[model samples]
Target: MTAWDQVLELLGSPLMQRALLAAVLVGAAAPVVGTFLVQRRMALLGDGIGHVALTGVALGWLVGSWAGLVPQDTLALPGAVVAAVVGSIVIELVRERGRTSGDLALALMFYGGIAGGVLLIKLAGGTNANLISYLFGSISTVSTADLWWTAALAVLVLGVGVGLRTALFAVSHDEEFARASGLPVRLLSMLVATIAALTVTIAMRVVGLLLVSALMIVPVAIAQLFARSFNRTMTLASVIGVVVSVAGLVLTYWQDIPPGATIVVLAIGVYAVAATLQPVLRRPPPPQDPHPDMVDDVLLVDDVDDADGATVRRPSPTT
Candidate 1:
């Protein structure tokens, strides 16, 4: 068969459809929450959460064997979600309490989670090979059930991440100010961590646990180069995520490369290209400390903006 015929044949396959849908959902959802993470200077939060989620996967596997569950892989995602949520909360609590340093807490979480996962898997009569797929991703093996889980979780992530963007932004921008404004900063911080955990779980199937944070952060990094406003950066990052995801899947179909690795490489390539061109393509400076009334609309949120005017008045903590 000719190359075009092979391409058409591959496109017509059912597996490709499932893979594409899962990829798009994951791609679109990851950056939504990632935007807030980047803004909060917690870009690596996803990585830490992903590492912790490994324990959940093994827990599910071990329990599934004990409970006679028919499909073990199906349980792993939910388990990862649960583990990730707990890990996120623990990390936040540690950071909030001021006793343990944040990085130290994350380091402990990393070692404990990964080690626990491996031990659990081995105790369950599994081996390192069982984890290879979860660590590096096995998108091609994503089943129909996995797709449904991805879609539902993706929607939840997008809704929470984007629906509460303003409030989330306020908290991420400045916790003390947000708290003073009665915006329920603590709850919002937890919510951000929850959304980030969900992002890690969902992306696990698409990009694997080890590389998930790259998907969460790289697109935002790329958008930072040219985005003139906070909203634009999110939009650009999300679009880049979706584009690279779909493109990576298609490229892997023909190139026989690992989809997760390819997708991450493509995103990084885009970032590199954008960075190289950033100087010549320089945009206007981010709106400088917009009027108090205009903070949410144009304060230009980036890794860390010093705009003192940034604040949100609606959706008071009581609300």
Candidate 2:
């Protein structure tokens, strides 16, 4: 059979289709959420959460072995999800409580989770190879179970994102003012924590916890190269993410490289090209007229609000 025929054969399989679908959704969703994290200067937050996700994977394995609730090496979705959420909350709370800087908190939580996970693995007597696969994902290992769980979490992330849009915007612009306005800042902060945790938990199975942050950051980072407005940035980020992931998966089949790493490397390449072209595309602002200032006599002031709640601005920015 020809190469095209082999590719078609793989695509025709239900399992392959499921894996592709999962990759597309995660590729889109991670960057969509990541834009917010990146804008808030919380980029390191994803890295921390991704590391903590390893603890969840380990705990899930331990739970499976101890309870005999699920077969060994089966999807441990629930255990991982729970552990990730708990760990994410712990990290955020540490920051909120003034116990440490966000970076320090993340490092502590991540290394602690890693240490704990290693101990658990040792206790379970699982082989090093098993841990290696969990640390770095194997595409062939992404089962139907993983796809379903990832799909469900993707939906949840989108839902929470939509519902929290206003609060997020407010908090992003001015946290102190948002709190003063009684916007439930603390609750919203926790919700953001939950969303970050959820993103990491679901992505771990596909990319492995070791590289989950790539899924979360790469697309958004690339999107930043092309978009100016926040909304446009997110939309473009999702599209870029989905396309890169699908392309990477296909390349993996051909080149025999790991799918997750391939996708990330492709994203970085795109970002680099965009970065190189950005300066050339951006035009310098037209020079201002050097004549007398036309608006020197204008004294701008905020007009009082009328009954209809419209502010009649006499002059602003024109002066």
Candidate 3:
């Protein structure tokens, strides 16, 4: 079959449809929150949260096995969300109250999360394959329910992100200035952290616990190379994410490669291309006049004599 015929056949499968929809939603949502994270220089936080989320996935599998209340796969996402949120809150609290630096706190959490996840997965009787799936993503296993939940998450992330765009921008760019302007800097920080955790959780379905940060950061980095404004960066990053996700999925379908790794590789490739061309693509500044004073003189305009009987006005620059 031709490439188009293969793509058409893949699209006809309901399972493929669900996987593609999940990928699209995740692709669209991750980079929106990610741009803010990238601006704040908190990109590694996604990786930390992804590690914590593994513990949550293990816990969900354990609970489901013990209670027989639901399928293990069905419970994993919620478990990951809850764990990730709690982990974010803990990180924030540590950064606020603990004497240790934020980097130290994140490092401690990252290691602890990975260790805890491994122990929990063992206790849950999860096989290495199960662990690998969560670590590297198993797009073929994404269900219809996963698709719906991912869609809802995409809506939430986009809505909250757009609604608070100005505040997020202000806080991200200059926290002290934003606080001086009476913006609740602390609250907004917490909100961004929480949203980032959620974004990581949603992206895990497509990129897995180990590489979710790639989805959240690579596109934003690429966007920054080409975009001069924050809004444009966000838009371009999101578009790049969607394109990579779809392309990755198609490649996986045709080549039997791991979907998560394929997606990340594609994103990194784009970033490489953007980085290579950035200097060429970037516009040069307009040349300044050698005789600035003469140019200023040309801009100056004489003011009309004031109401005072004496003419006191002097030439002043028009601009």
Candidates' lDDT values, in order? 0.88, 0.76, 0.85
What alpha-carbon RMSD in Å does predicted model 1 have with respect to the real structure?
A: 11.7
Q: Model 3, which residues run further than 4 Å from truth?
A: 98-100, 284-319
Give the TM-score comparing model 2 with the true structure, all chains together: 0.85
Point out the higher-scoring one by lDDT: 1 or 2: 1
Q: Please provide TM-scores, in order, for all candidate models, with all chains considered together.
A: 0.86, 0.85, 0.87
Best by lDDT: 1
The candidates, ranked best first by lDDT, are 1, 3, 2
Candidate 2 differs from the real structure by a C-alpha RMSD in angstroms, to one decimal, of 8.4
**Relative to the unseen true structure, what is the C-alpha lDDT of residue 271 in candidate 1, on a scale of 0 to 100?**
91
Mind giving the per-residue lDDT tens digits that candidate 1 earns over 102-121? 88999998899899999999
Residues 1-319, model 2: lDDT tens digits: 9988998987997767876888888887888778778767787787787777667777778877876755664535676678778877887677778744777888887798788777876666566566766667666677777777888889989777766767776776677899899998877777877888888877775577788777777778877776888778878888988898888887876687888778878888988888898888888766765454454454344444456777555543435
TM-score of 3: 0.87
Candidate 2 minimal-lDDT segment of 10 residues: 296-305
Model 1 weakest lDDT span, ten residues long: 310-319
